[model samples]
Target: MQKEIMSNTLKILCADMVQKANSGHPGAPMGLSDIAVVLSHHLHLNPQDSSWLNRDRLVFSGGHCSALVYSLLHLWGFDVSLEDLKQFRQLGSKTPGHPEFGHTHGVEITTGPLGQGVANAVGFAMASKYAQRILGENVISHFVYCLCGDGDLEEGISYEACSLAGHHQLSNLILIYDSNKITIEGGTEIALSENIARRFEAQGFDVFECDGHNFDSIDLAIKSAKESCKPALIIAHTVIGKNAVGVEGSHKTHGAPLGAEVVAASKEFMGFEKDQAFVIAQEVKSAFEASIAKGMSECEKWKKSLSQEVQSKIAELQNPDFSQVQYPAFKQGDKVATRVSNGEILNAIARSYSGLVGGSADLGPSNNTLLKNEGDFPKGRNLHFGVREHAMGAICNGIANYGLFLPYCATFFVFSDYMAPSVRVASIMKTQVMYVWTHDSIGVGEDGATHQPIEQLSHFRAMPNLLVFRPADANENIACMQVALEMKAPSAFVLSRQNLEVLSPVSKDQVQKGAYVILESENPDVILLATGSEVNLALKGAEMLKNQGKSVRVVSMPCMELFSQQDQAYQDSILSNRNKTIAIEASRGMEWYRYAKVVIGMDSFGASGKGDDLFVFFKISVEEIVKKAQEI
Candidate 1:
């Protein structure tokens, strides 16, 4: 009876809040409230200590139900309060339209993008499994639960992430699908027709079905899912809006507030005071607080059970010593692909940093991201993310948010388009994730225009908090990783497919400054600025210009984001912002306008040919740079 009342309490609060905001989704919260009540009993979490490592993770893939999220966070004894709930959907409020990880006290990650939370759940599960392998079951044992709706499952990324989750047999993962059979466009029958149970079953999940509002059935399904030997999916059948006068079970309630009169009617129907808003009966509060206390007790018991080795392991993950990493050395003039160099640097870091773990999207051979002799995830360092690029990026973001792993995902530079949404989310969350994007331009060679990246470099560089590195050579690639790994944000290492000449060693400290003069000329008549493969071309161009009595300053701008952060004085020291400044790169180079007066960039798509032939055809060669410099 208390569970029933608590479910209604949550529903009423959700309805009240949405009605007050006049612009929030109330349907999902109302529909999922019963399941949320049942889940509260099984979920292990301490609001008193939200960072408890052994606590089960809960992800709401349908973030539109944020009213439910804030209510749960408040009722479960987290820092969220009734006032915070009142401020729902307001700017500067803890309860934003979508739950933000750093902004909200209990949000595990930023979710709003459909299907990302499903993938994040897989990532959390995978991270826990791997941590358990390292610290033993007693120190690292936890389950991951994800509540997702039709929109989440309908997105392609969900399929990609779920496929990988099943392939990995992540037994600790449980995905609770809120099978409401409704979307914003009306009934899901208007679009989706797949048998979701069969799809999950085919993907190797242990599938269960339950009446969402039936407490006993929901509890039974959850208990059964917990016992499964593989990742589990429980489809909870529900209505879009379970209880609202005139609006019940209709898609109209999906993204709008339940009318005040209707909310009053619904509350009265549930045996609550029709006029009261945000009322949690003392009995319901006690039940929820008791659950939190139980979770705190479990957290304490787990803390006491932690062995010394496990504690040390946990500490290592929390405070990684980047200084301990032994970077690989490269000699000047040595020919090596930035991809190969980054692979060596990655292995070097993996040998020292146990938290450094990731893999490529079925492009390990090309991306060169395989950790040497370190085995596979749950026991080893490599995490084979399959060909699911979209899932790969989101999963890596999840691992980063899991609080121990410094995750990375790799693919051909051009394929990043398929995964840009995840990468964008990672940047927004500021997850310490690395991206190894090889074949960094038309340099992908014979793959043709379809496979070559033209604008990826500038597009990503434009993203906030994401350090996009277009390394000039093997040494620069090493420096980029060294710098990227030390920072607490997402980064992408745009590496070369073709071997580049290793320039004279640049200190990691210098690389941290973002851009510097790689080759200096006394009283330079022109500044030749380039990145990645074009830096070497700039050097040869500078030499030719010198022979032609034109003094040149060749600068390698590896990371424009970092450079932008530098003070104007430091920026002016390298760039000087002169009319003769020429920026050259194999990509679109849109952001170069800030530093260069003349930009020589890819204006059109590339075609199938050898990488060198493609460079020549695209005029991304030393001759082109020289011509541009002379004009400047």
Candidate 2:
């Protein structure tokens, strides 16, 4: 009876929050209330220690059900209050329309875009496995639970992430699918028809079914799921708006509030006074208090029983010291592709820091991202993410959020489009994920226009909070990697497939500022700015112009994002008044206008040929750069 009242209280609060806002979804929370009640009772959470390392993670994959999560957090006493519930969906409120990870105390990850949370949960599960392997099960053992809806399963990314989870045998991960058979538009039967259990079984998941509203059935299914040798999926059959007075089980109840009269009648029917709102019975409060006290006791026991070695490991994982990291040095004039340099630096970092873990999207060799000799992940440091770029990105974010690892994902620069959404989420959440993107330009050669990336650099540079680096040579690549490691936000290293000459007298400190004059000419007539492969062309063009008695300065602007963040004084120092300033790169040059008077770059797709031939054809060569400089 107490459990039933607690479930009803959750539903009433969710309905009231949404109705007061006159916006937001109320159906899933109402339908999933009973499951939430059961899960809340069983979840290993300590409200007093919300950041406890071994605590189980819960992701609301169907994030429109934010009301339910907020209500549960409030009831469980995690800083969310009755006033916070009243302020749902309002501007600057802790209770935003969608659950934002860092913005809320217990929200795991910023989830709103359909299937991202599911993918993130997979990542969280993967991180847990990795942590357990390193720290031992006694120190780190927990489950990753996600509440997803039909729309989450319908999205393609969920399939990608879930497939990887099954392949890895992440038995610690459990997905509770609220099979309410409804979407905002109408019944899910209109679009979805696949047997979900069969699909999951095919993906190597232990599948189970239960009545969502029945606490005993939900508990039994979860118990069986925990004992599985493979990842598990519990399909909890439910009715949309399960207990609403008039609109129960109807599609109209999916996104809108039950009218005030319906809400009052529903409360009355649930044995609550119709006149009151946000009311929690005393028994529900006692039940939560008992659970919280038990969790606190468990947390205290875990802390007391931890060995000194395990405690040290935990401390190191949480706070990594990168200041003493010694980076490998590069010789000037060495003909090395930035991708190869990136691989060398990655291995060096992995050797020094156990927290560095990630893999390419099945492009390790080409992207040069493998941590050589570091076995496979969960046992080895390297992760082979197969060809799933989208899942790989979210998985990296998950690992980063796990608070022990610095995660990175790699792919060809052109394929960044496949992972852009996840990358955006990382930026939004300020997760310190690194993206190693190789084959950064038309220099991809005979692979042709389809394989080369012309606008990707500009697209990423435009995104806020993302540090985009296009290192000119080996040394700059190392410097970019160093900066990425130290940065609090996400970073991407756009590396080259073709070898570049290691520029003489490289300044790692200057590169940290984003752009630096590689070769400064006294009394400069023209300032030539470039990045990646074009930096060498800019240098050669500067020499040619200098031979013609025109003093020219060459600047390697490897990271536009970092450069833009510099103070106006520093920017002016590098981009001071000159007779003419020209920017050269192999992609669309519009972004260069902020620092240069003329932009020399590709305005069309590349042709299939030798990389050098394509560079000449695209007029991104030394000769063309000189000609343009002469014209200027």
Candidate 3:
């Protein structure tokens, strides 16, 4: 009876919100009401203490199911009010159509993009385990539960995360699939038909089946998952619209609304009073309120246990200092490519920073994310994010949100576009997730324009609250990494695919200041500014001008975002509009017009050839830089 009342409240809330917004997904919420009611009412979570260290995590991988989530949160005593629901999909409202991180109070990860939440759940599971192992004791031991749909399971990213979850045998992870056999396009059979349960089973998950609309079945399935010592997946078969009259059991009602008239008729069919708005039975409300105190009591017990554990292991909990996770000891002449230097620094940081966890988007070896001799994050130390770049980015945010790991995600710079939204949200939250992007420019020869990142550097630089650093040499790369390690906001390190020389004369301190004096010139006529692989070009070009009797200053601008934050006087000192300036880089010059007198940038797409030839074709050579400077 309590379950029935909870289900009615969820359905009513979802219908009202969508009807008011005139723009939202109603089918999923209606279909998933039973599961939502069961989890919110019966799961081992405390509404009174939302951030309990060991509280069960609920991630909605099928984010379009947000209506269902919001309804549950509202019923279960989050800050969301009736007015907040009324303001759904409106500007500045917390209850937006798609769940947004920081926008909504309890949304675990910003979901919207299909399958991102699924991967985020994997990260959450990993973070909890890592926290327990490093922080010690059972201070953090809770299952990461995810509610997904056909769209989520169909996405490639889900497969990637699931594979890693299976490999690590993350028994604390549980996924509940809402198998309604429908998508926006039509029957899922029209597009996809794969053995989902068998797939998860092969991935080493304990699979269960149940009737999604049956509260008893869902409750028992979740219980089975909790008891299992391995990751569990429950495929709950359900109707598209469980009890919405004519459309109750069909795919037609999966996306479109039942209309006001149809909604009225459906309400009658479900034995509800006519024209009732946001209706919830008093009995059901009382029942949920009764459980609130019980949930609070259980949460308090967990809190006491955590407090006791902290007291026993104060030293390990406090100074678990991971500030130096994956970096090398700072030295004057650390000669290595930015990518190589990144790996070395990351390994060093990993040694001390137990919370430093991350993985590559399937390009582990190429991305240089694997640590030497250090254990793979095999569901234990590091993360294996598979090939899902977008999901990997969002999941990294979740890992950071776990308040334990300073999560870093890696991949080629070009592919970072796919993961942009996830990284963007991380920036909004000021989560210090390190983004390691290798193959920074047109230097990725033979792979052609598809692989070469002509506009990627500019793209990252465009994002607000993000630090985009492209190091000139090995030492500068180390310096940039040191800065990333210390940052409180999101940072991206762009490295070259080609091996670069270890240039001398620049120190780590200078790089940390954002722009440094690579070569000072008295009475300089022009400033040659460069980043990444092109920094050496600027130096060589400056030499050519020097022989020609031109006093040229070379400045390595590793991080434009950081440099811009410097005092106005310092900015003027480093780069003056009064002084003729030539900026050189290997990527598109779209972002360089603002700072240089004449910008030598890759204006066209790259071709298949040797890296040097590609550089020549793109006019990214020191000779070109010298010529451009001479012209200026």
RMSD of each: 1.1, 1.5, 3.2
lDDT (10s digit) by residue, model 2, range 356-469: 899999999898888878889779888888989988898888888888889989999999998998999999999999999999988899999999999998899999999999
lDDT (0 to 1) per candidate = 0.90, 0.88, 0.78
Task: Give stretches of model 2 more than 4 Å off.
Answer: none
Query: Which residue runs of candidate 3 sit more than 4 Å off their true CA positions?
Result: 135-137, 249-257, 307-334, 361-366, 378-380, 384-391, 414-421, 442-451, 497-517, 520-524, 564-572, 607-614
lDDT (10s digit) by residue, model 3, range 1-632:
76776776777678777877877777788888888877765556676567666677888887777778777777667777778888878999888877876677777677777787888898888887777675564666678999899988887778877887887788889999989998877789999889998999999999999899898999899889988878999999988776676777676676566678767776776668759867767776666666555667778886676655475453443245544344454444444667877887778877775556788888878888886665666435556776778768877877887765677889999899988877777776677789999988877788888888888888778889899989887777777777776678899989888888787745556766778768888657889988988887888888888898888998899998888788888887788763388888887767777778788887776777878788887777877877776776
How should the candidates be ordered by TM-score, best one leading?
Answer: 1, 2, 3
The superposed Cα distance between candidate 3 and the true structure at residue 503, in angstroms, equals 5.1
Counting only residues 3 or more apart in sequence or on different chains, how many pairs clash (N, Cα, C under 3 Å) in candidate 1?
0
Query: Using lDDT as the measure, which candidate wins?
Result: 1
Which candidate wins on TM-score?
Answer: 1
Candidate 3 accuracy as lDDT: 0.78
Worst 10 residues of 1 by lDDT: 286-295
- Global CA lDDT computed for model 2: 0.88
Residue-level lDDT of model 1, residues 1-632, one tens digit each, is 98998898899989988988999999999999999999999988998889999999999988898999999999999999899999899988999998888889989988899999999888899999998898888777789999999999999999999998898899999999999888988899999999999999999899999999899999999999999999999999998778787898999999998888889899888998999898988889888777567778999999998888788889998898888888888999889999999999999998898888999998999999999999987689899988899888888878989999898889999999988998998888888999999998888889899999998887898899999998999888878888987898999999999999988888888899999999987679999999988998898998998999998898999999999899999988898856879999988887888888988889998999999998898888888888887776
Which portions of model 1 miss their true places by more than 4 Å?
none
- Candidate 1 yields a Cα-based lDDT of 0.90
